[model samples]
Target: MPGLGVCLALAASAAAPPVFVPVERFTLAWTHSIEKVRWEEDYAVVASPTAGQPPVLQARTARVRGSGAGMEPPDDAVLRNGWYEYTPRMGSPQGLRLTRSPYTADYAWCVDGQCVPLGQWLPSDGGVTLLTPCARPPAPER
Candidate 1:
């Protein structure tokens, strides 16, 4: 019985958590007007504290518009948001797809509804590019 107990402890240590921590949150801090719009597929980079753990890739869907929608806009409104979690096995090759045009610079990356930096913007292709100046590690919370 003692030997079995030891094995169980070892096995449990190797398991990953069912949910990951939400490091940071942000809202639209700034906005930029683009001359042209393009629809591209991108990935959101997330961090995990566990060592030897791979970065998480979340799917993101975004849309931009020249003007804001009036009261009770259409279901396919000009603006939309989606959140995703990271998987260790998938790595960064797979990310969310953005199916909108007129990409506006006004949209900002955020966590928990707060504005964050460009570095937080993890590319779906496994590239770490800092899109903003206020890049910081995500807090240890949901």
Candidate 2:
């Protein structure tokens, strides 16, 4: 019986598939006037809502993940959680770089990093309103 148990354990181990952990995905969104920028860990997209106008200047960052079925992040993007709050990562940058393209566009932004002087391009009227990191939606109760 002991030998039979040993054989069963070996078979189970052989049949088990290796585990592959997915990378954590993060996203940051920034808007200035009609210009909007969405940055993910791996890629960045900038769009000018009005023709001829460039994307906005001010920016904000958030931790974003998929909310519905069939929704997928870009090929370079990951899909993980944990963007609500921040703690400095010892010698690293204050916050994670949210966009792939850092400074080329005004909307490119970072989150939870050390405070910096606001750019002249950012609108003064509303200014920048940082978003509170939000909780991931609960899975539908089946």
The TM-score values for the models, in the order shown, are 0.27, 0.19
- Candidate 2, clashing residue pairs? 25-78, 25-80, 35-56
Q: Write the per-residue lDDT of candidate 2 for residues 1-142, one digit (tens) a residue.
A: 0000000011123353222111122233443222332323221223334564322222222233332233333344434553232222222221222221223343432334422222321222222222212122234599
Name the Cα RMSD for model 1: 15.2
The numbered model that scores best in lDDT is: 1
RMSD of each: 15.2, 23.7
> How do the residues 26-136 of candidate 1 rate in per-residue lDDT, one tens digit apiece?
222333233333222233545434554444443344333333323222355444342121222333333222221234342344555455433234322222122211123
For residue 38, model 1's alpha carbon misses the true position, in angstroms, by: 12
